[model samples]
Target: MTIHFSCTQCGKCCHNLRLPLSLDEAADWIRRGGDIELFCEAIPWPVEPPQSDAQAAHKRRLSFAAMCGAVPIRVIVTVVAAFDGACPHLLHDGRCGAYGQRPRVCRIYPAEVNPFIHLTPASKACPPDAWTTDKPVFFANGQTLDSETSELISQSRAVAAQDAQLKERLCAYLDVHHMALANEGFAIHKRAPDVMLAALERLKHDRKQVAHGAAATWRFVSNRLSTVDTLVSIGADTAEVSSLPNALVSYIAFFPSDV
Candidate 1:
Protein backbone atom coordinates (compact mmCIF):
# COMPACT_ATOMS: atom_id res chain seq x y z
CA MET A 1 0.00 0.00 0.00
CA THR A 2 1.29 3.45 -0.98
CA ILE A 3 0.12 6.91 0.10
CA HIS A 4 1.25 10.30 -1.19
CA PHE A 5 1.57 13.58 0.76
CA SER A 6 2.73 17.11 0.08
CA CYS A 7 2.49 20.04 2.48
CA THR A 8 0.91 22.94 0.63
CA GLN A 9 2.31 25.19 3.37
CA CYS A 10 -1.18 26.66 3.68
CA GLY A 11 -0.41 27.05 7.41
CA LYS A 12 -3.75 25.56 8.37
CA CYS A 13 -1.89 23.20 10.69
CA CYS A 14 0.10 25.96 12.38
CA HIS A 15 -2.75 27.88 13.93
CA ASN A 16 -5.05 27.54 16.92
CA LEU A 17 -3.05 24.89 18.80
CA ARG A 18 0.00 24.22 20.88
CA LEU A 19 3.14 22.68 19.36
CA PRO A 20 4.70 20.02 21.61
CA LEU A 21 8.42 20.12 22.36
CA SER A 22 10.86 17.52 23.61
CA LEU A 23 13.10 18.41 26.53
CA ASP A 24 16.09 19.01 24.29
CA GLU A 25 14.14 21.11 21.79
CA ALA A 26 12.68 23.19 24.62
CA ALA A 27 16.09 23.82 26.14
CA ASP A 28 17.45 24.85 22.79
CA TRP A 29 14.52 27.23 22.30
CA ILE A 30 15.23 28.78 25.69
CA ARG A 31 18.94 29.07 24.92
CA ARG A 32 18.11 30.87 21.67
CA GLY A 33 16.66 33.72 23.76
CA GLY A 34 13.09 32.58 23.40
CA ASP A 35 11.02 33.60 26.43
CA ILE A 36 10.30 30.17 27.83
CA GLU A 37 7.50 31.31 30.11
CA LEU A 38 5.74 33.42 27.51
CA PHE A 39 6.01 30.80 24.75
CA CYS A 40 6.01 27.47 26.54
CA GLU A 41 3.75 25.54 28.96
CA ALA A 42 4.18 22.27 30.85
CA ILE A 43 1.20 19.94 30.37
CA PRO A 44 0.89 17.18 32.96
CA TRP A 45 -0.25 13.73 31.95
CA PRO A 46 -4.02 13.46 31.42
CA VAL A 47 -6.28 10.91 33.11
CA GLU A 48 -9.43 9.40 31.68
CA PRO A 49 -12.53 9.34 33.84
CA PRO A 50 -14.55 6.21 34.45
CA GLN A 51 -16.89 5.27 31.64
CA SER A 52 -19.46 3.12 33.46
CA ASP A 53 -22.10 4.54 35.77
CA ALA A 54 -21.03 2.47 38.77
CA GLN A 55 -17.42 3.42 38.25
CA ALA A 56 -18.42 7.05 37.99
CA ALA A 57 -20.25 6.81 41.30
CA HIS A 58 -17.21 5.29 42.92
CA LYS A 59 -15.06 8.09 41.54
CA ARG A 60 -17.45 10.67 42.93
CA ARG A 61 -17.14 9.12 46.36
CA LEU A 62 -13.34 9.32 46.10
CA SER A 63 -13.59 12.95 45.00
CA PHE A 64 -15.78 14.10 47.89
CA ALA A 65 -12.74 15.28 49.83
CA ALA A 66 -11.24 17.85 47.42
CA MET A 67 -11.31 18.61 43.71
CA CYS A 68 -7.55 18.43 43.30
CA GLY A 69 -7.53 15.13 45.14
CA ALA A 70 -9.55 13.68 42.29
CA VAL A 71 -7.02 14.67 39.67
CA PRO A 72 -5.27 11.67 38.14
CA ILE A 73 -1.64 12.36 38.95
CA ARG A 74 1.33 11.53 36.73
CA VAL A 75 4.95 12.66 36.35
CA ILE A 76 5.29 13.24 32.59
CA VAL A 77 6.69 16.56 31.38
CA THR A 78 5.50 17.80 27.97
CA VAL A 79 6.12 21.38 26.93
CA VAL A 80 3.92 23.10 24.38
CA ALA A 81 3.09 26.49 22.89
CA ALA A 82 1.59 28.60 25.67
CA PHE A 83 -1.06 30.48 23.72
CA ASP A 84 -4.43 29.49 22.35
CA GLY A 85 -3.49 31.55 19.30
CA ALA A 86 -0.96 30.90 16.57
CA CYS A 87 2.55 29.77 17.40
CA PRO A 88 4.88 32.70 18.06
CA HIS A 89 7.48 31.11 15.84
CA LEU A 90 5.09 31.02 12.93
CA LEU A 91 5.81 33.77 10.47
CA HIS A 92 3.12 35.97 8.91
CA ASP A 93 3.66 34.18 5.59
CA GLY A 94 2.74 30.74 6.94
CA ARG A 95 6.29 29.57 7.32
CA CYS A 96 7.96 28.58 10.56
CA GLY A 97 10.55 31.05 11.78
CA ALA A 98 12.31 28.21 13.57
CA TYR A 99 11.92 25.68 10.80
CA GLY A 100 15.47 24.43 11.08
CA GLN A 101 15.02 23.75 14.79
CA ARG A 102 11.37 22.69 14.82
CA PRO A 103 10.23 20.09 17.32
CA ARG A 104 10.05 16.39 16.41
CA VAL A 105 6.26 16.45 16.41
CA CYS A 106 6.29 19.13 13.75
CA ARG A 107 8.93 17.31 11.78
CA ILE A 108 6.76 14.19 11.73
CA TYR A 109 3.55 16.01 10.91
CA PRO A 110 0.75 14.24 8.93
CA ALA A 111 2.38 10.91 9.70
CA GLU A 112 1.03 8.43 12.21
CA VAL A 113 4.03 7.79 14.45
CA ASN A 114 2.33 5.34 16.80
CA PRO A 115 4.05 2.03 16.20
CA PHE A 116 0.86 0.13 16.97
CA ILE A 117 -1.01 1.80 14.14
CA HIS A 118 -0.49 1.45 10.42
CA LEU A 119 -0.23 4.62 8.37
CA THR A 120 -3.08 5.33 5.98
CA PRO A 121 -4.34 8.56 4.41
CA ALA A 122 -7.48 8.39 6.53
CA SER A 123 -5.45 8.32 9.73
CA LYS A 124 -3.23 11.30 8.89
CA ALA A 125 -3.76 15.07 8.97
CA CYS A 126 -3.18 15.57 5.26
CA PRO A 127 -6.02 16.84 3.11
CA PRO A 128 -7.89 14.43 0.82
CA ASP A 129 -6.17 15.94 -2.20
CA ALA A 130 -2.76 15.46 -0.58
CA TRP A 131 -2.84 11.70 -0.99
CA THR A 132 -3.33 9.23 -3.87
CA THR A 133 -3.39 5.51 -4.40
CA ASP A 134 -0.50 5.77 -6.81
CA LYS A 135 3.02 4.56 -7.28
CA PRO A 136 6.02 6.58 -6.02
CA VAL A 137 4.14 8.06 -3.07
CA PHE A 138 6.54 10.58 -1.68
CA PHE A 139 6.58 12.46 1.62
CA ALA A 140 7.14 16.20 1.75
CA ASN A 141 10.88 15.52 1.84
CA GLY A 142 10.63 13.17 -1.16
CA GLN A 143 11.19 10.04 0.90
CA THR A 144 8.71 7.19 0.35
CA LEU A 145 5.94 7.10 2.95
CA ASP A 146 7.05 3.67 4.10
CA SER A 147 10.60 4.86 4.70
CA GLU A 148 9.54 8.12 6.39
CA THR A 149 6.93 6.49 8.59
CA SER A 150 9.38 3.85 9.75
CA GLU A 151 11.99 6.47 10.62
CA LEU A 152 9.41 8.60 12.39
CA ILE A 153 8.09 5.70 14.48
CA SER A 154 11.61 4.84 15.56
CA GLN A 155 12.36 8.45 16.47
CA SER A 156 9.12 8.83 18.34
CA ARG A 157 9.89 5.74 20.42
CA ALA A 158 13.31 7.07 21.38
CA VAL A 159 11.84 10.38 22.43
CA ALA A 160 9.05 8.68 24.35
CA ALA A 161 11.58 6.51 26.16
CA GLN A 162 13.56 9.57 27.21
CA ASP A 163 10.39 11.20 28.50
CA ALA A 164 9.48 8.04 30.42
CA GLN A 165 12.88 7.91 32.11
CA LEU A 166 12.58 11.53 33.11
CA LYS A 167 9.09 10.92 34.43
CA GLU A 168 10.33 8.02 36.53
CA ARG A 169 13.07 10.07 38.12
CA LEU A 170 10.71 12.96 38.70
CA CYS A 171 8.08 10.75 40.32
CA ALA A 172 10.64 9.04 42.52
CA TYR A 173 12.07 12.38 43.56
CA LEU A 174 8.64 13.69 44.54
CA ASP A 175 7.60 10.40 46.17
CA VAL A 176 4.66 10.24 43.78
CA HIS A 177 3.37 7.15 42.02
CA HIS A 178 3.48 7.04 38.20
CA MET A 179 0.45 6.30 36.03
CA ALA A 180 0.66 6.11 32.26
CA LEU A 181 -1.92 7.67 29.96
CA ALA A 182 -2.07 9.42 26.63
CA ASN A 183 -1.49 13.03 27.84
CA GLU A 184 -3.94 15.59 26.47
CA GLY A 185 -5.32 19.12 27.12
CA PHE A 186 -4.10 22.63 26.40
CA ALA A 187 -1.88 24.41 28.88
CA ILE A 188 -3.24 27.53 30.53
CA HIS A 189 -2.24 30.62 28.59
CA LYS A 190 -1.70 32.82 31.60
CA ARG A 191 0.66 31.57 34.32
CA ALA A 192 3.26 32.89 36.67
CA PRO A 193 6.28 33.24 34.40
CA ASP A 194 8.63 33.19 37.36
CA VAL A 195 7.39 29.77 38.43
CA MET A 196 8.22 28.20 35.05
CA LEU A 197 11.49 30.07 34.74
CA ALA A 198 12.64 28.66 38.04
CA ALA A 199 11.62 25.19 36.92
CA LEU A 200 13.59 25.51 33.68
CA GLU A 201 16.69 26.47 35.60
CA ARG A 202 16.33 23.49 37.91
CA LEU A 203 15.74 21.18 34.93
CA LYS A 204 18.90 22.34 33.22
CA HIS A 205 20.93 21.98 36.39
CA ASP A 206 19.58 18.50 37.02
CA ARG A 207 20.24 17.36 33.44
CA LYS A 208 23.88 18.33 33.79
CA GLN A 209 24.27 16.53 37.09
CA VAL A 210 22.49 13.43 35.77
CA ALA A 211 25.69 12.03 34.30
CA HIS A 212 27.51 12.13 37.65
CA GLY A 213 24.99 12.33 40.52
CA ALA A 214 21.51 11.49 39.28
CA ALA A 215 19.96 10.66 42.62
CA ALA A 216 21.28 13.81 44.28
CA THR A 217 20.13 16.07 41.45
CA TRP A 218 16.64 14.61 41.51
CA ARG A 219 15.93 16.72 44.57
CA PHE A 220 15.77 19.82 42.38
CA VAL A 221 13.20 18.19 40.12
CA SER A 222 11.29 17.10 43.23
CA ASN A 223 11.16 20.70 44.42
CA ARG A 224 9.59 21.80 41.14
CA LEU A 225 6.84 19.16 41.32
CA SER A 226 6.31 20.07 44.97
CA THR A 227 5.63 23.63 43.91
CA VAL A 228 3.00 22.47 41.40
CA ASP A 229 1.37 20.28 44.07
CA THR A 230 1.27 23.15 46.52
CA LEU A 231 -0.30 25.47 43.98
CA VAL A 232 -2.93 22.89 43.07
CA SER A 233 -3.67 22.31 46.75
CA ILE A 234 -4.14 26.00 47.38
CA GLY A 235 -6.43 26.33 44.40
CA ALA A 236 -8.52 23.34 45.51
CA ASP A 237 -8.99 24.80 48.99
CA THR A 238 -9.94 28.29 47.94
CA ALA A 239 -13.42 29.33 46.89
CA GLU A 240 -12.02 32.50 45.39
CA VAL A 241 -11.81 31.72 41.70
CA SER A 242 -9.15 34.32 40.94
CA SER A 243 -6.70 32.76 43.36
CA LEU A 244 -6.19 29.60 41.37
CA PRO A 245 -3.16 29.08 39.21
CA ASN A 246 -4.07 28.90 35.52
CA ALA A 247 -2.57 25.40 35.21
CA LEU A 248 -4.58 24.16 38.18
CA VAL A 249 -7.74 25.55 36.69
CA SER A 250 -7.19 23.52 33.52
CA TYR A 251 -6.15 20.41 35.45
CA ILE A 252 -9.19 20.42 37.69
CA ALA A 253 -11.51 21.26 34.83
CA PHE A 254 -10.49 18.06 33.01
CA PHE A 255 -12.07 15.82 35.63
CA PRO A 256 -15.55 14.16 35.56
CA SER A 257 -14.97 14.06 31.76
CA ASP A 258 -18.28 15.66 30.91
CA VAL A 259 -17.13 19.21 31.66
Candidate 2:
Protein backbone atom coordinates (compact mmCIF):
# COMPACT_ATOMS: atom_id res chain seq x y z
CA MET A 1 0.00 0.00 0.00
CA THR A 2 1.16 3.54 -0.76
CA ILE A 3 1.31 6.23 1.94
CA HIS A 4 1.03 9.94 1.19
CA PHE A 5 1.89 12.66 3.70
CA SER A 6 2.07 16.45 3.78
CA CYS A 7 2.50 18.28 7.09
CA THR A 8 -0.42 20.61 7.81
CA GLN A 9 1.75 23.10 9.72
CA CYS A 10 -0.19 22.27 12.87
CA GLY A 11 3.15 21.65 14.70
CA LYS A 12 1.86 18.91 16.95
CA CYS A 13 4.96 16.87 16.18
CA CYS A 14 7.17 19.73 17.28
CA HIS A 15 5.57 20.12 20.67
CA ASN A 16 6.51 18.02 23.66
CA LEU A 17 9.23 16.60 21.46
CA ARG A 18 12.28 14.56 22.22
CA LEU A 19 13.83 14.58 18.78
CA PRO A 20 16.69 12.12 18.20
CA LEU A 21 19.95 13.75 17.21
CA SER A 22 23.51 12.82 16.31
CA LEU A 23 26.37 13.36 18.75
CA ASP A 24 27.46 16.61 17.16
CA GLU A 25 23.89 17.80 16.82
CA ALA A 26 23.38 17.03 20.51
CA ALA A 27 26.34 19.26 21.42
CA ASP A 28 24.96 21.93 19.12
CA TRP A 29 21.60 21.62 20.87
CA ILE A 30 23.09 22.22 24.30
CA ARG A 31 25.13 25.09 22.90
CA ARG A 32 21.88 26.58 21.70
CA GLY A 33 20.50 26.15 25.27
CA GLY A 34 18.50 22.99 24.57
CA ASP A 35 18.41 20.00 26.93
CA ILE A 36 19.78 16.52 26.29
CA GLU A 37 17.93 13.39 27.33
CA LEU A 38 19.58 9.98 27.02
CA PHE A 39 17.02 7.29 26.33
CA CYS A 40 18.74 3.95 26.92
CA GLU A 41 17.62 0.34 26.50
CA ALA A 42 19.44 -3.01 26.27
CA ILE A 43 19.06 -6.28 24.42
CA PRO A 44 20.28 -9.54 25.90
CA TRP A 45 22.90 -11.12 23.68
CA PRO A 46 23.66 -14.81 23.22
CA VAL A 47 20.64 -15.28 25.44
CA GLU A 48 19.75 -14.42 21.85
CA PRO A 49 16.46 -12.94 20.76
CA PRO A 50 13.86 -14.85 18.81
CA GLN A 51 14.33 -12.53 15.87
CA SER A 52 15.91 -13.56 12.59
CA ASP A 53 19.46 -12.50 11.70
CA ALA A 54 18.17 -9.65 9.54
CA GLN A 55 16.22 -8.25 12.47
CA ALA A 56 19.27 -8.65 14.69
CA ALA A 57 21.41 -6.80 12.16
CA HIS A 58 19.06 -3.83 12.28
CA LYS A 59 19.36 -3.72 16.08
CA ARG A 60 23.14 -4.08 15.94
CA ARG A 61 23.40 -1.19 13.51
CA LEU A 62 21.73 1.10 16.01
CA SER A 63 23.22 -0.19 19.27
CA PHE A 64 26.59 -0.52 20.95
CA ALA A 65 27.51 -3.85 22.45
CA ALA A 66 28.38 -4.02 26.16
CA MET A 67 28.45 -6.43 29.06
CA CYS A 68 25.85 -6.55 31.80
CA GLY A 69 27.84 -8.51 34.35
CA ALA A 70 28.49 -12.01 32.95
CA VAL A 71 25.63 -11.67 30.48
CA PRO A 72 26.46 -10.04 27.16
CA ILE A 73 24.16 -7.35 25.75
CA ARG A 74 23.76 -4.63 23.20
CA VAL A 75 23.03 -1.06 24.35
CA ILE A 76 21.15 1.52 22.36
CA VAL A 77 21.45 5.17 23.40
CA THR A 78 19.13 7.64 21.71
CA VAL A 79 20.48 11.14 22.23
CA VAL A 80 17.46 13.38 22.09
CA ALA A 81 16.80 17.10 22.19
CA ALA A 82 14.14 16.77 24.88
CA PHE A 83 11.99 19.88 24.76
CA ASP A 84 8.48 20.73 25.82
CA GLY A 85 5.76 23.11 24.56
CA ALA A 86 7.41 23.69 21.20
CA CYS A 87 10.83 23.20 19.64
CA PRO A 88 13.01 26.19 20.32
CA HIS A 89 13.55 26.65 16.60
CA LEU A 90 9.91 26.37 15.61
CA LEU A 91 8.94 29.86 14.51
CA HIS A 92 5.68 31.54 15.46
CA ASP A 93 4.91 31.80 11.76
CA GLY A 94 4.74 28.00 11.69
CA ARG A 95 8.10 27.66 10.02
CA CYS A 96 11.40 26.24 11.15
CA GLY A 97 13.85 28.80 12.50
CA ALA A 98 16.83 26.54 11.85
CA TYR A 99 15.55 24.87 8.72
CA GLY A 100 18.79 24.68 6.79
CA GLN A 101 20.84 23.44 9.76
CA ARG A 102 18.21 21.21 11.31
CA PRO A 103 19.17 17.68 12.33
CA ARG A 104 18.66 14.73 9.94
CA VAL A 105 15.85 13.48 12.19
CA CYS A 106 14.05 16.74 11.70
CA ARG A 107 14.24 16.34 7.97
CA ILE A 108 13.15 12.73 8.15
CA TYR A 109 9.95 13.51 9.94
CA PRO A 110 6.83 11.26 9.49
CA ALA A 111 9.31 8.59 8.38
CA GLU A 112 11.02 6.06 10.63
CA VAL A 113 14.71 5.28 10.79
CA ASN A 114 14.08 1.65 11.62
CA PRO A 115 13.09 -0.11 8.44
CA PHE A 116 10.93 -2.55 10.38
CA ILE A 117 8.63 0.22 11.60
CA HIS A 118 6.18 0.86 8.80
CA LEU A 119 4.85 4.37 8.62
CA THR A 120 1.31 4.56 9.96
CA PRO A 121 -0.33 7.96 9.80
CA ALA A 122 -2.96 7.13 12.40
CA SER A 123 -0.20 6.34 14.86
CA LYS A 124 1.32 9.78 14.35
CA ALA A 125 0.28 13.08 15.91
CA CYS A 126 -0.46 14.66 12.54
CA PRO A 127 -3.97 15.85 11.70
CA PRO A 128 -5.93 13.56 9.37
CA ASP A 129 -5.89 16.12 6.57
CA ALA A 130 -2.08 15.91 6.51
CA TRP A 131 -2.33 12.49 4.89
CA THR A 132 -5.21 13.45 2.58
CA THR A 133 -3.16 15.77 0.43
CA ASP A 134 -3.22 14.74 -3.22
CA LYS A 135 0.30 15.47 -4.46
CA PRO A 136 3.13 14.16 -2.27
CA VAL A 137 4.03 10.51 -2.22
CA PHE A 138 5.96 9.63 0.92
CA PHE A 139 5.90 5.87 0.78
CA ALA A 140 4.86 3.21 -1.68
CA ASN A 141 5.01 -0.56 -1.87
CA GLY A 142 5.98 -0.68 1.79
CA GLN A 143 9.12 1.35 1.11
CA THR A 144 9.93 5.00 1.18
CA LEU A 145 9.46 6.46 -2.29
CA ASP A 146 11.08 9.78 -1.62
CA SER A 147 14.74 9.49 -2.54
CA GLU A 148 15.74 12.27 -0.18
CA THR A 149 13.89 10.70 2.73
CA SER A 150 15.50 7.35 1.93
CA GLU A 151 18.95 8.93 1.82
CA LEU A 152 18.38 10.75 5.09
CA ILE A 153 17.26 7.53 6.72
CA SER A 154 20.42 5.81 5.49
CA GLN A 155 22.58 8.59 6.86
CA SER A 156 20.76 8.46 10.17
CA ARG A 157 21.51 4.75 10.53
CA ALA A 158 25.11 5.15 9.40
CA VAL A 159 25.71 7.99 11.84
CA ALA A 160 24.08 5.96 14.58
CA ALA A 161 26.53 3.08 14.02
CA GLN A 162 29.45 5.49 13.77
CA ASP A 163 28.49 7.15 17.06
CA ALA A 164 27.64 4.00 19.01
CA GLN A 165 30.88 3.31 20.85
CA LEU A 166 31.53 6.92 21.74
CA LYS A 167 27.96 7.27 22.99
CA GLU A 168 28.46 4.25 25.25
CA ARG A 169 31.54 5.87 26.76
CA LEU A 170 29.70 9.18 27.15
CA CYS A 171 27.07 7.36 29.19
CA ALA A 172 29.77 6.13 31.53
CA TYR A 173 31.05 9.63 32.26
CA LEU A 174 27.48 10.69 33.02
CA ASP A 175 27.07 7.62 35.29
CA VAL A 176 24.16 6.31 33.12
CA HIS A 177 24.52 2.56 33.50
CA HIS A 178 21.02 1.36 34.12
CA MET A 179 18.81 0.36 31.17
CA ALA A 180 15.33 -0.99 30.55
CA LEU A 181 15.07 -4.32 28.73
CA ALA A 182 14.81 -4.13 24.98
CA ASN A 183 11.23 -3.45 23.81
CA GLU A 184 10.07 -2.96 27.40
CA GLY A 185 10.87 0.77 27.62
CA PHE A 186 13.77 3.13 28.09
CA ALA A 187 15.42 4.40 31.23
CA ILE A 188 15.55 8.11 30.57
CA HIS A 189 18.52 9.98 32.00
CA LYS A 190 18.33 13.73 31.85
CA ARG A 191 21.74 15.27 32.28
CA ALA A 192 22.54 18.65 33.74
CA PRO A 193 23.44 21.11 31.00
CA ASP A 194 26.96 21.72 32.27
CA VAL A 195 27.68 18.03 32.90
CA MET A 196 26.25 16.86 29.55
CA LEU A 197 27.91 19.55 27.51
CA ALA A 198 31.20 18.84 29.26
CA ALA A 199 30.92 15.15 28.46
CA LEU A 200 30.05 15.89 24.86
CA GLU A 201 32.99 18.28 24.70
CA ARG A 202 35.25 15.57 26.05
CA LEU A 203 33.75 13.19 23.49
CA LYS A 204 34.45 15.72 20.76
CA HIS A 205 38.09 16.27 21.76
CA ASP A 206 39.30 13.05 23.35
CA ARG A 207 38.89 9.59 21.86
CA LYS A 208 41.34 7.32 23.68
CA GLN A 209 40.59 7.65 27.37
CA VAL A 210 38.05 5.05 28.47
CA ALA A 211 35.48 5.55 31.19
CA HIS A 212 35.59 2.84 33.91
CA GLY A 213 37.70 0.82 31.45
CA ALA A 214 36.96 -2.92 31.71
CA ALA A 215 35.28 -2.44 35.06
CA ALA A 216 32.10 -0.66 33.99
CA THR A 217 29.05 -2.88 33.92
CA TRP A 218 25.48 -1.89 32.98
CA ARG A 219 22.53 -3.14 35.01
CA PHE A 220 18.89 -3.61 34.08
CA VAL A 221 16.06 -2.23 36.20
CA SER A 222 12.45 -3.37 36.23
CA ASN A 223 9.40 -2.34 38.23
CA ARG A 224 8.42 -5.89 39.12
CA LEU A 225 10.62 -7.72 41.59
CA SER A 226 9.95 -11.00 39.80
CA THR A 227 11.45 -9.65 36.57
CA VAL A 228 14.44 -8.38 38.55
CA ASP A 229 14.92 -11.81 40.07
CA THR A 230 14.66 -13.49 36.66
CA LEU A 231 17.46 -11.34 35.29
CA VAL A 232 19.60 -11.66 38.39
CA SER A 233 19.38 -15.45 38.39
CA ILE A 234 20.69 -15.42 34.85
CA GLY A 235 23.73 -13.36 35.83
CA ALA A 236 22.38 -10.14 34.37
CA ASP A 237 23.03 -7.30 36.76
CA THR A 238 19.88 -5.58 38.05
CA ALA A 239 18.63 -2.88 40.41
CA GLU A 240 15.37 -2.06 42.13
CA VAL A 241 13.13 0.19 40.03
CA SER A 242 12.25 2.28 43.08
CA SER A 243 15.90 2.86 43.92
CA LEU A 244 15.91 5.83 41.55
CA PRO A 245 13.50 8.62 42.44
CA ASN A 246 15.13 11.81 41.34
CA ALA A 247 15.29 14.39 38.63
CA LEU A 248 18.23 12.81 36.83
CA VAL A 249 16.76 9.44 35.88
CA SER A 250 13.53 7.47 35.48
CA TYR A 251 11.97 4.55 33.60
CA ILE A 252 9.00 4.57 31.22
CA ALA A 253 7.66 1.25 30.12
CA PHE A 254 5.54 0.42 27.09
CA PHE A 255 3.69 -2.39 28.78
CA PRO A 256 2.80 -3.43 32.30
CA SER A 257 3.64 -7.07 31.57
CA ASP A 258 7.37 -6.48 32.16
CA VAL A 259 6.83 -8.63 35.25
Best by TM-score: 2
Top lDDT prediction, candidate number: 2
List CA RMSD, all candidates: 10.4, 2.6
Name the lDDT of candidate 1. 0.45
Report lDDT (CA) for all predictions.
0.45, 0.84
Per-model TM-score on C-alpha atoms? 0.54, 0.90
Clashes of each: 0, 0
Residue-level lDDT of model 1, residues 1-259, one tens digit each, is 5456667677766666555665566556666544332211122213445556664433332121111233433333445554456777889998999898877777777665544345566655556666654434664342335576558656765775565445334323333221112122222322344444444556556754553222211110111233444435633211222233334223312222321
**Residue 129, candidate 1: alpha-carbon lDDT:** 63
- The TM-score between candidate 2 and the true structure equals 0.90
Write down the TM-score for model 1: 0.54
Lowest lDDT sum, 10 consecutive residues, model 1, at: 214-223
Q: Flag regions of model 1 displaced more than 4 Å.
A: 30-75, 120-125, 138-149, 168-198, 208-249, 252-259
Task: Report the C-alpha lDDT of model 2 over 209-238, residue by residue, as the tens digit.
Answer: 654573357989887777789888989988
